[model samples]
Target: MKLLLFEDKLRENFFPLTLTRFTGDLRCGALKLRQRLEALLTDDEVSFLIDSSIEDLYSERHPDWQINLIKPGDKLFVNCLLKYSPTLFDKIQTLDHEQALVQGNALVAYRSNKDHGSFDPDSVLKQFGISTENVDDALYKHPADLVHDNGRMITYDFDNFFSDKDNSFETEPGATILNPYNVWLGEGVELKPGVVIDASDGPVIIDNDALLMHNSVVIGPAYIGKNSIIKVAAKIYENCSIGPVCKVGGELEACIIQAYTNKQHDGFLGHSYLGEWVNLGADTNNSDLKNTYKNVVMHSYNDRPPFDTNTMFMGCIIGDHTKLGINSTINTGCVVGTGSNLWGRDLISGYIPEFSWGEASLLQPYRIDAFLSTAQLVKQRRQLKLSNKERSLYTSIYHRYQENQ
Candidate 1:
């Protein structure tokens, strides 16, 4: 059977994170949603059906993968937003042809034989005679959900993928590890002197080429991705996932940081989800809990007021290509949009629109030319070029935001 992962209409719920990529690409634990699915369904031919807006960019990044290609055979279409679980996996394995598994209003998966050009859940249901099967499996309704479930996912990924006994690397003197059996150190991992890894609570998996510098402390369940650096005296709390090529320091608690980001200064980032290419300036801190300890309310891309998250701990959700100024303070449950530059000592709060300039009180639309120029420079620093496709996408988003205003 062929496996096709598809992003549905609720993609906007993820906002700025989903602005540049697909929902399946978002990282929660050691692996991305797509990677987890691919690993579980290894026997099947896998493909994707993503939004048209990011098709070119996605194709450019992954040229080998198939997108929106439906072959004439038994096909299993799974929702990219569905959280991975043993029950979900077993149910998917038992799915019969022309069966649609759903959870409330959300589509979980569909098994079909007819090859249609459009493969959205709604389109598939409309075109074929399918029997609906309701499921209780959870779906990721917001970005904050990833943060809430990070620790559990980390433990799950570790037990399933890295439970083998392999002690290949050596740690420097003064580097200590607690619950050594629960820790997995990948190839070329460097644990400098005075580094302490405490996995008494849960497992810790440091990927290949990752460096934990002097005096750094990491508690589990946590995942430090490939080539990431934990700076000197850094304290990484449990339930944190730092993606590949990142440089992080200070204190991080229950956060999901995407690839190529930097938070390498002394700051406290808690319960936050940061997108790629983001840089948190020195002393940048966010308040996860409110003064009253009430549930945090966050702004969404949908047409509605800020809604309660039902959780007291909710930090900022920063979009890709955004940079925070030194000593910038982010308020609880703040949502900062893509391509924005925030500076000054003021408290960055509320919903910041895309490509915004200036501080929280007086945000202005960032000039497209200036944004693009800086973006090009940022990419160049990483030895990558800002291609015409990216420029065109950014420009269109800028115009769309302006037209709406």
Candidate 2:
């Protein structure tokens, strides 16, 4: 059977995070949503139905995988935002042709026998003579949902994927592990002296080549991704996912820091989602709780007004390639868009538009040439380059912002 993961109409609700990648690529647990789904459907051939904005980039990154090209056959279509579980997988596997599993108005998965050149959930439902089956499975509606669901997802991913695995590396002398059975270390992981891992509440999975320096405390459920570094005396609280090649320090709680980002300094970041290539300079911190302790309100790309998140804790949603200078202060529920540079001691709050430059109150559009140059340099530090395709995409985004202004 062919398995196709597709994004739906609510993609813009994720905003700046989804601006650079697909929703399925978001880190929910120890693994991405797509990764967990692929693991469960290992027997079937996998493909993706992604937005046209990212089609070329996705195709360029994963040359071997099929994107948007549907063939005539019995196929299983799954929503990328659907939260994965063993029970859900079993239910989806039981789907017969022309049947769709839905949760409320959102279609979760369907099995179809008809040939469709492209994927359109409405078209598929109408043309395939689909019969609907109601399901209670949850779907991610906003970026904060990733933060709120992280701990549960971590436990689920660990129980399903790593529970049977033996430690691939030995813990060094003076490195302490509480509830050792709940901790899984991957190959080449270095746990330096004074490093402590506490997993009594939930599991902790440290991926390959990760380094935990002296005096660091990791309280699970948490994930330290491949080649990532936990700086000295860093406090990584429960429900945090630090993605591959990141350098994290200070304190983090219920946060998802995506790949190649750096927070390698003393700061407190809580209940937030950060995209790839983000940098938080020394002592930069964000406020997760308001002075009145009210539910946080955040701006959405599709929603004109800021909407209530229904949660008292929310720090910020920072887009890819954004940078914050030393001692920067981010107010509760702030949203920073892509390719921006923000600095100063003033409190940064409200919705900052894409490619914005300068202090919080004195924002201006960043020169496209200058932003691209800096972006190229940033990638080159990791031995990667900003390709022509990426450059064109960035240019288009900049022009779109300009056109709106």
Candidate 3:
């Protein structure tokens, strides 16, 4: 069977993050929503139905398969917005062939004999049926929903990544392991002394070449990615996902860091998401909870008004290639766009647009040439060069931003 993962109307709710990647690419746990779905449907052929804005970049970044392609057989179309649940298959099991499984005001999934229809997201769903009534609401509706319920999503996705018949990795001696069976290790994973992994609350999975440095504590429901280093005395609390080749230190809880990022300094990042190629300078702290204990309100470029998250805890969301100077502080629910450079003595908050050069109140639009030079230097530090394709992509996005302004 062919599996089609479709993005619905809620895509706009994911704003700046969705500007560079698809909704399914957002990291809620060890695996992306698309990866989590693929793990469950291992036997079927899978493809993503993403937005046109990211088509060029997405196709270039991932060239393995052609998306939106359907074979001449029954296909299982699934809504990528929903949380990956074991009951998903059970819910659709009762539906007959050619019948679309829907809740109230959304298209859950459907079985079609053939895949011959306009794949446009706006018009495709109408061919089936979609409405918002009072049925079992979709697990996801906005980007904030991903952050609000990420802790639970971590536990669910973790089970699929590490557990597949006696999931076992490796660990060095002299490190404390709280529930060995619940932890999964990848190849060549090294551990230093005075490192404690508490897996009682949930499972801990460390990927290949991940170094658990001296005196660090990583609680369960956490993940350490490949070639990543957890610096000395760092306290990584529960429900966090650190992607590959990252250097994380300080304190973190319920956060997600994409690949090739750096936070190797003394700081507190909680309940947030960091895009790829981010670098957090020393002592850069983000406020996750407010003093008044109210739901976090976030401002964005996707719309005119600042939106309410209705969640009590939320940190700042940093986009890719964004760098923060030493002691830079960010306010709660702030959104920083990609290619932004911030370093100033002030505590910054609010929405910082892409390619912005600033220190809080003072911000200047970063020129494309200057931004590309800095981006190339940052990539070179990791022994990688910025590709021509990436340069073109950035140029396109810059032009689009100018048009919007």
Candidate 1: where is the Cα deviation over 4 Å?
126-128
* 384 Cα displacement, candidate 3 (Å): 3.1
Number of clashing residue pairs, candidate 2: 0
Off by over 4 Å in 2: none
Report lDDT per candidate: 0.89, 0.89, 0.79
RMSD of 1: 1.3
Instruction: Summarize candidate 1's per-residue lDDT along 174-269 as a digit string, tens digits.
Output: 999998989999989999999999999999999999999999999999999999999999999999999999999999999999899999999999
| Per-residue C-alpha lDDT of model 3 across residues 126-185, encoded as one tens digit per residue | 664432222365557656677666667667766755675376654557789888877888
1 or 3, which is superior by lDDT?
Answer: 1
In model 2, the clashing pairs are none
- Report residue 178 deviation for candidate 3 (angstroms): 1.4
- TM-score for candidate 3, please give it: 0.92
TM-score of each predicted structure versus truth: 0.97, 0.96, 0.92
Residue-pair clashes per candidate: 0, 0, 2
lDDT per residue for candidate 2 within 1-405, as digits (tens), equals 898999987688888888889888999989898998888875778889999998888888889988998888989999989886678878889999888888887888999878787788756655536798788845788888889999999999899888865654577899999988899998889999999999999999999999999999999999999999999999999999999999999999999988999999999999999999999999999999999999999987754677688899999999999999999999999999989999986789988888999999998898989999999999999999998888887887788764465
lDDT of 3 at 103: 62
RMSD of 3: 2.5
